[model samples]
Target: MTLALAGGALAQDAQKGGTLRIVGTADLDHFDPTSGALVTTNNFLRATQRTLISYHASTDEEERIRPVGDLATEVPQPTNGGLTYTFHLREGAMWNTPGGARQITSTDFERGVKRMCNPALGSAMLTYFVSLIDGMDTFCDGFAEVEPTVEAMKAYIEENDISGITQPDDLTVDITLSETAGDFIYMVSLPTSAPAPIEVLDYMPDGPEYRENFIASGPYTPVDYVPDASLTLARNPAWSAEADPLRAANVDNIEITFGIQPDAAIQQLQAGDADMVYDITIPPAILSLLTATADDKVMTMSAGRTAFLFINTVSDNNGGALKDLRVRQALNYAIDKTALVQQMGGPAMAQPQSGIFGAGVLGYHDFDLYPSEGDAGDPEKARALLAEAGYPDGITLKMPYRNQNNQPEIAQTIQAAMAEAGITLELTPVTASDYYSKFMTNPRNTEEGAWDIAPVGWAPDWVGGAARSVFQPQFTFDGRHQTYNYTDYNNPEANEVAKQAINATTPEEAARLWAQVDELVMADAPVVPYYSEQVVLYRGPAVENFQPYALGGQGDWTNVWLNR
Candidate 1:
């Protein structure tokens, strides 16, 4: 397969009509990018929507280390020592409507950014992505106590009292940062930068309607959507050939289904019922089948998302299980990640993720001690530690799991390991929707149904420590931090250390500090590391110009085509 950037050259005789059916295990709790805060949902938005500047899927290794550009013609560059960024908007870019009419323009970009940054809009992305843009932080702060209301946010924007953003002209906007940000390009690739004509999200604060009905500036526009079930896309007729040369406007429709299990999705793919499946947890059965059929038709790809066990430290229940660092460490040591991955699939096909940022990311180190000598599946050692803590049996711990491809089997593997280590794990697998809402979003409390451990994953929003913000305290409501720092394993010193790493002056310094943060996390054992997923983008044998990588979906499918 050719490694080409998004919108690169493709076959001239590519089929102009066909349907691509994509099936996956789950759907976003909500379609709104700011509110859903789930990576799975965001993946759809990435392909179906467009960001101002996206990291190029086919840049050099160094350029790929950070985002280059996806929508914007060029990557934003700073004029001063990273204080000011001059972004040149791509000309002729316009929004696409489902009805196949004309497109919209730069104002859409402007309003989108404002909506995302608006605190009253109640977008969690504001806490994550808004911090990157100039004055956005201040604009957000201006609304902090002003009630999270749409009218208030719109009024704030109309008055132009936002601190960091300056739209001096219609096409030219200047962003002044609070401090020097060398990896500004990385910040641009986040969903917050993905423009959403402010008008669409104006009154609607929370719901899937906005995403299902809203117009987009992407290659495809949402033509149909069924709640928690399916979404269909049609070529954006407004897509200009000058701006997006490889736009197929072909493949008559792209249909995406949600809530279908990965194993089911794989079966559908084998039966030719589906064209692609996202959110696939590598299952051993599927891997064997793909390997057996290597000659005929099969391809698998690994994306940059990492799955792990989120141990809620702040939970008032669980009887201080997470409070004991020794217990956390024991849990970390007892589980055989290699066995888990193998049970799920092959090691060659899937890598065990070590840190928050997987292989595709820079400054990532295999900091987690799993896969190391003495740490991998040391059941005796784990038991010894548990006994040392107090040979207390009958500790029925609840473990939550979402129905991914191999999750049930994976959970069994973990349960078996923990049981052998003298810890009783009660497998409580919940529906995908309830699993996300109850276990994931619930505040940490004794009353809130707590889980001893649950699967959690993240896709980097930006390239730097900002990507690590999920682990930060602010992201969690007053109660739970189930994402990363969920274990209530708070260390003021470590917090300061990570802050120093994020705010570090140089890349080298920042890397050193990030290493320190990793060391702290591993030492604390807040999470048990799991496999890094291989991005699997299934296409018919006739399809061409599609590359799969960690950065984004289908690794720039802009030039993809089907043989008629």
Candidate 2:
């Protein structure tokens, strides 16, 4: 009933394919993995094109997942409180160029993780993400008082008496944390886990060259990378066919052009000029066109991402109207998620999200687990809450938003809902670039309070219960937590619980603790809890075996085929 794959089937099946051209809206400021602050962009570069410990694709109900032999031969074994991992280097793994010059080794991983943790690198990644390891927090925090020089960082590592990490051999690494954390393996499974060559790194001049020459031991190797413009990757010929399809790339070469001048990239796809559009949020007009006119060319999938309206707690009005828990609760009840999703083709075309982590993620908690505090279309209750908060009938608030067309539409829907309960809204829309450069760059400025409320969104980096990391006291970008705590939300108890969740040893235990934190956040209502984002994708007809998941984008491109 089934045909077995022929020997050298992968290579035999390979047709020395045409270059797959992927166009998108944004380009990496730097190609270094640690430099990424957003999830979708980071995962696109890390998951399909690069190799690491684990990979995930889109989800229907279950998390469609795949992971190749990255730097590990098997599931990591834990000693004390961290990991002791051994990677049996697949001899075939090499850089994209010939002569197998980029062959992977144990030493590469040592250098990579060390570089990731090094304070001198000034990577935001090392701070919050890697702190699950015992000594990493101290190393990341060491940069605070004194200049974190290379010698100082190296000496700090050399002198640490922690049981968290050890490089026992060139290919083996061991870690012991402060406590036995449940997601220990998942922590190491991050993009940070992928190793970099110390040799090439030795030549970096503490500048952009560090990003340009960023190497890969995964499926593709960087050839040329232009910041805010384009990135090109060629296949690693030495990459074995037997490697995990989850982490491999099938195409011979890949070209990703960025900052594609809004709507230009979509035009290319409509003209059949691109293999795919990786991360650009397609506009509704283009989405409708794809469905009605180019149905054959569009492939849609659900992504594990969430989008919501965040209220700044530090606002001059103490988060303005949103400061009132009842008002915040009323806003959550006012929006029609079903209708909003229908217009954007959200839940149907992309993964429908309600909870923070989205469905199928390992540690996700059901919204029902906590008492529902917001308006569920109860006009009477909404009016009662608003009245209790002493809001007058003529209250108006200006909510600033990034100019995603759907966002304004969603805001209007909320406006209409609130209108029914006697409230008016002045929906303020601005360009995405301006929105980020202004309000998001610094939320604490005196003038920043001009905007009373706005929609905020987040996409997680991994599948672990650490999804709660976003709620950690406040969200942090780079080393400065104050800027992103736009809500200026401060709860010592919630912050403490977030730390506990990070170090919790089991999902049951972590969930129990995080549940408390989630309840606290939902109750605070700094931002009205809204729907999660769904990633909608369009695949070309020739592309086959395109399984989608949250963490991995472009699916498992390694086994995909272009029908010749």
Worst 10 residues of 1 by lDDT: 473-482
Q: Which digits, one per residue and each the tens of the lDDT, describe model 2 over residues 1-564?
A: 332221113434544465677776655433565444455555445532333366444333343433334546666555432544344545555554333356566555555555565544434345444555666566545534434554555555444433355557645656556555555555556665556654444433134655555555566666777765777777655556555434545577778887664367777765667757665777777787777775865555444456666655456563366666777666555544555556566555543234445543444566632223332344555666777777746356667776644566777876776676666667877765456545564545424576666766665555545454455424433344433466446666766776687667676777777767766666666555456555666755456445554454444444455553
lDDT of model 2 at position 398: 66
lDDT of each: 0.60, 0.55
Query: What is the C-alpha RMSD, rounded to one decimal, of candidate 1?
Result: 4.0
Best by TM-score: 1
**Tens-place lDDT digits, model 1, residues 1-564:** 543434354345455677767777766565555454555555456555666665544323334344554556667767767788766566666766555543444455556666665443455445444555667666655656565566666676666544565656556657777766555666566665565565664556544456656666666767787767888877776666566432444566778888887667777866767766655553667667777777344555434556778676666555676667777777776777776667656666667666655654445666666444533477777777776666555255778887656677888988887777777888877777667555665555223546777776665555434435434532223232223344445656566676676567777787777667666666767777776765545554555555443344443444455554
TM-score of 2: 0.78
